[model samples]
Target: MRADAKKNYGRILEVARTVIAEHGSDASMRDIARRADVGLATLLRHFPTREAMFEALLCTNLDALTQKAVALESSNPPDVALRSWIREWVEFARSYRGVVTMMAAAHTNPASALYASCAAVHSTSARLLSNAQAEGTARPDMNGDDLFALMTALGWAVDQPSFAPRADHLVHLITSTVLLGRVG
Candidate 1:
């Protein structure tokens, strides 16, 4: 990419992140363009679709989540690492307003741009779950698919304005259900 084009692309993504955080995944592309001080055509040229924009926005968070999960596995006890990674996953899902629905949809759609990120998240969760299960800290029956579904539920819980305050409790309860021992 040319320097100016690359700069514009980065600016649009940065603005979109802020707008999406304030508004939602449904945040308007026009508004993002306005915020970024770029033409709508330029934004469209770079992103092409809402899904593509979402995929770009999610790349940073997903990378961080993957890195954090790996770090936790090395640094913490099996159960603790699993729980910590779960909490981080929930936070990642909650960071973008209305992202849970998008993630859920993209998670199953192999053609979606967000699919790779979803797969990476699922893989990370699976590794953590497997480690915990091997250590007898988590239930053996729960797999990566199950953990992904539960994480989506956690995202949904935190997405609601009313339920947001209780998200931590919800996480603890759900973790208890998957882990061998209660979390809270």
Candidate 2:
């Protein structure tokens, strides 16, 4: 990328993060471009689509979550690490106002720009889950994908105003169920 193009791209992503956090995953690209002090054409040249822009914005958070999962594996017990990572995943899923919905939608759509990032998340989640299962800390019946779905469900629930107050309790309850009474 050219110097000016790279600068625009970085600026767009930086502004998009703030704009999307304020407005949600559905925030307009034009608004983001305006905030970034770029033209719509410039933004489009970089992101192409709204989902692509959202994906780019989310990539940093997703990468952090993946890295957290990796670090927890060696730093904590399997059960503790898995549960901790799930909590982190839930927080990541709910970071933006409507990000859980966007993640849910992108999670299954292989063609979506965010699919690769979501898949990487799932891969890391699976590693944690499989490790727990192997260590007899988690249920053998549920796979990583199942855990991912359950975590996302909890994320969506906690994102609601009604559930926001009890989010931690909800996370613990779901974690207990996922752990199948093996939590320690």
Best by lDDT: 1
- Per-residue CA lDDT of model 1 for 1-184, tens digit only, reads 9999999999999999999999988899999999999999999999999999998988988898899999999999889998988788778767899988988888888999999998888888999999999989899988999998998988988988999999899888888998887464
lDDT of 1 at 139: 92
For model 2, the run of ten residues with the poorest summed lDDT: 175-184
Name the TM-score of candidate 2. 0.92
Per-model lDDT: 0.90, 0.85
**Alpha-carbon shift of residue 162 in model 1 (angstroms):** 0.9
- Candidate 1: regions farther than 4 A off: 182-184
Estimate, for each residue in 13-117, the C-alpha lDDT of model 2 and write its tens digit.
Answer: 999888877887778888998999999999999989888887888888889889988899999988999999988977875677778777778888999998999
Deviation of model 1 at 104, angstroms: 0.8
Check candidate 2 and list the clashing pairs. Answer: none
